[model samples]
Target: MNEKNTLLPRQLGDTHIRLLRIYKVVIESGGFAASEIELNISRPAISAAISELESLLKMKLCHRGRSGFAITDQGEKVYQSTLQLLGNLENFRSEMNAINTDLVGELNIGITDNLVTNEQQRLTRSLSTLKLRAPEVVINIRMISPNAIEAAVLDGQLHFGVVPELRSLSGLTYSSLYQERSQLYCSEEHPLFDKNNEAISDSTLCEYDAVIPNYPQPIKIKHQQKKLKSTATSTDREGLAFLILTGRFLGFLPVHFAQQWVAQNRLCSIDSHNRYFDTHFFTITRKGARENLILEAYLEELEKTL
Candidate 1:
C-alpha cells in the first residue's frame, strides 16, 4: 500500500461518506449486479464506486470476477465500522434535536396515502436513519386521511402527522416538508387521450365523465375537480386511479403517483399545464405537549433528509 493510502484524510467529507455508503450497499446486496437496482446506478458505476472506495482505503474490499462474488475479511470489518459510524452520527443528531433527550421510546407517525413514488423518498429514508440511531425504538406508522391524522395528533394519539397543508388546526405545530402537484389524467382509451391539450377546452372537458373525491378537498382542489362532470366518486386515490384507468372517467392524481401509468402510455395528463394543483405538505405535532425524545430525534433525522 502506498504511504498516502495508508492513512485516512485528516477530515472525512461527503466524498468519503459517499464511497462508504456505496461499499456498504454493495456488501449488503451481496454483489455489484444485485446492488444496481437498489443503488439506482449501472454496473459500471457500481464498479467505479467500489474501485474508488478501495483506492481510498488502500485495500481490496471484495473479490469480484467471473469466479464468484465474495467479501474479503477486511470488507466485513469495514462494513461493521460503517454501521458504527452511522450510529454515532445519528447519536449526535438525536442529542442536537433535543436537550438531554434519550433515544428510547416509540414514534407513532401518521402519513397520507400514495406518496411512495416521491423521488426523494425523504420520509422512508429518514425513518431508516432514525432506526439506526435507536434500534430498539418502536416506530409505528399509520396511513389515513389528512383530517383524521390531524385529529389524532391533536388528541395525542399520534406523535407526528404528515398531511397536505390544506388547513392548519389550532394547538398543533406544523413544519413544512414536501410539496406535490396533481394534474388531471385520463387513460389512453379515453376520447381525449389522443387530443392535443390546446384542443381540450373547459367545455370539452366538461363533456366527459369525471371522478371526484368523496373525501374533503381544499378550495383549489375543489375548483379543479369541478372543471369536469362528476359522474363518479372515489374515497381514495387508488379508487380514483382505477376509475381513470377504466377510461370512462377522468381524475386528478399526483404526478409522481401517476408516473408509472403515464410511462406505460396507459395514462396521460389532460391540460396538465392548466388543470393542476399543488399541495404543500407538513408535519404536525401537539404544540404544547411535554417533551418527547423519540419524536425530537426523528424530527432531527427527518430535517437532515429535507
Candidate 2:
C-alpha cells in the first residue's frame, strides 16, 4: 500500500452512523429481542446492523446467547464515545437553529413523579401552548426523582426540571411554582386509624413503622425522626403510597394525592385539625448555560399557565 493510503483515516458514512444508532438502541433496550419494538426494526436486521458495526470497527462489540446479552469492554468505550459524538452533533444543530427566532429541536425535561393528578400543576396546559407556539419542537419528558431531576438539569441531560426545592445547588436557578401540602397518613388497618384525633399521642405515633421520602428533605426528615418509626423509604409518591396502603406502615403523602383514598376510607390523616407541612415546587434550570429559545418560549407558556 502507498504511504498516502496507509495514512488515510477511515471515514464513517451515514450508513455507519445509522448502524451505530441501532447498536445504541439495542444496548439501551438491554437485548435484541427487547429492542425490536423500540427500533421499529426486525431482530435479524438489528443483528445485521450490530454485525456491520463490529466489522467496520474490526472488533466484537457484544455477546448474545441463551445466557443473556452483554457488551464487551471495547463496546462500552464505543458507546460512551458515540453518546458524546451524538450529543455534540445535537448541540451543533441547536446552535445553528438558534440563529433563527423559530423554536426547533428537542427540549428535554425532567420532573418528580405523581404530577398527573395534581390540580395545581399546569404542565399539560403549558405543553399544549408550547405545541401551538413551536410545533417543530420535540418535547421529551422524564419522570424522575427530585434529586435526579436537579442532577440531570445540571449535567445538561435535561433543559429544565420541576421539583420540590431541596437544599439549593449553587449552579442552578429556581423559580417557585406552588406549594403542596403533605400530611401524616395511616391505612384503615393500622392501629391508629380508628382512634380519635386527640387519642393519638406523639409517643404513640413514634411506635409504628413509617415510610418516608428517599431523598433528603429537611422537614420530612425532622418530622420522621421525631414522630415515626422509620421502616422504609421511597423516592416517588407511588412507592410511598404503596407502602402506606399495605397497612403495615405510616407515611407522609401529598394531601391532593391521598384525597381519593381518604374519600374511599382506605386512608386517613392522623391529624383531624388538618395539620400539614408545605413543600414548595419550582422550575429549576442551569444558571450560566447558553439561553435556549425553545426553553425560554416553553417557560413563558408555563408561566402564563401558572
> Which residue segments of model 2 deviate by more than 4 Å?
1-90, 194-199, 219-221, 272-275
Worst 10 residues of 1 by lDDT: 89-98
Best by lDDT: 1
Provide the TM-score for each candidate, comma-separated.
Answer: 0.66, 0.70
lDDT by residue for model 2 (169-277), tens: 9989999888887878889999878553744667777789998776677676466445677889886789999999999998888889999998999998886453467
Among these predicted structures, which one has the highest TM-score?
Answer: 2
Measured over all alpha carbons after superposition, the RMSD of each candidate to the real structure, in angstroms, is 15.1, 6.5
**Reference-based lDDT, residue 170, model 1:** 82
